[model samples]
Target: MSIEANLEKIERLTSKVWRSYSKEDPLGHLSFNEYDYLKAIQAARVPIRLTDLAKELEVTKPSATNMVKRLERKGLVLRVSCSEDARSKRVMLTEKARAPLESESEIYTIIAQKLKVHLSEQEFDALNTLLTKALR
Candidate 1:
């Protein structure tokens, strides 16, 4: 196979692997965007404003609000008033979200173990470095 074909195959496999995690989502019908927002909020460890979420994702504020609303309905996140500014709302993950987040992580660990069968340790490290560089 040509290098181009190999690269395309990698792209497909990467998307497939990432997309596979959501199928077992316990949050009912969380979309990829919602999962991303939840992941961002969980990673932040600080209360993040809806506007900030929008900015961080390079999306519109209304879009972020909509995503938050959906997550709110699912009981995965809550919109709390900012302590310093009551008028603004910050998003935070609820305890309910912890299970699904942990589950997704466990699934990734399993995926990594499966991937290890096909790549050497050095090759895996190189792949990670190259993928990060490509994103940048």
Candidate 2:
């Protein structure tokens, strides 16, 4: 298979694995986009303003607001009045959000471990560097 085909297959397989894990794990139902938002919110380690969240994700404010609304509906996040700016609201992860994010992290670590076990250290490092550069 071509490199692109292999990459696409890897993505699909990884997502399929995540879907299976989600089925067995009670908190794994979140969509990839939802997970992205949740991870970003969690990374802040404190309530984050919608604007800042949007900037962090490199998305528009409206896009961030819409995702937050969806997350709130899912009971994964909460929008509270910003103490420093009453006009703006900060988004915080709900208690319900924690388990799934942790599960996602575990899934990633498992996949990485599998890859590391298969590849030599130099090969894995090169792949990591290439992947990071490709993203940039």
Candidate with top TM-score is: 2
TM-score of 2: 0.77
| Candidate 2 lDDT score at position 52 | 100
Report the lDDT tens digits of candidate 2 across residue range 1-136: 7999978977886887677666677555668788799989999999999999999999999999999999999899999999898899999988888776666777777667767897999999999999999998
TM-score of each: 0.75, 0.77
Q: Which residue pairs in candidate 1 collide?
A: none
> Which candidate tops lDDT?
2
Segments in model 1 whose C-alpha atoms lie over 4 Å from true places: 1-24
The ten-residue window of minimal lDDT in model 2 covers: 20-29
Q: What is the model-wide C-alpha lDDT for candidate 2? A: 0.87
lDDT of each: 0.83, 0.87
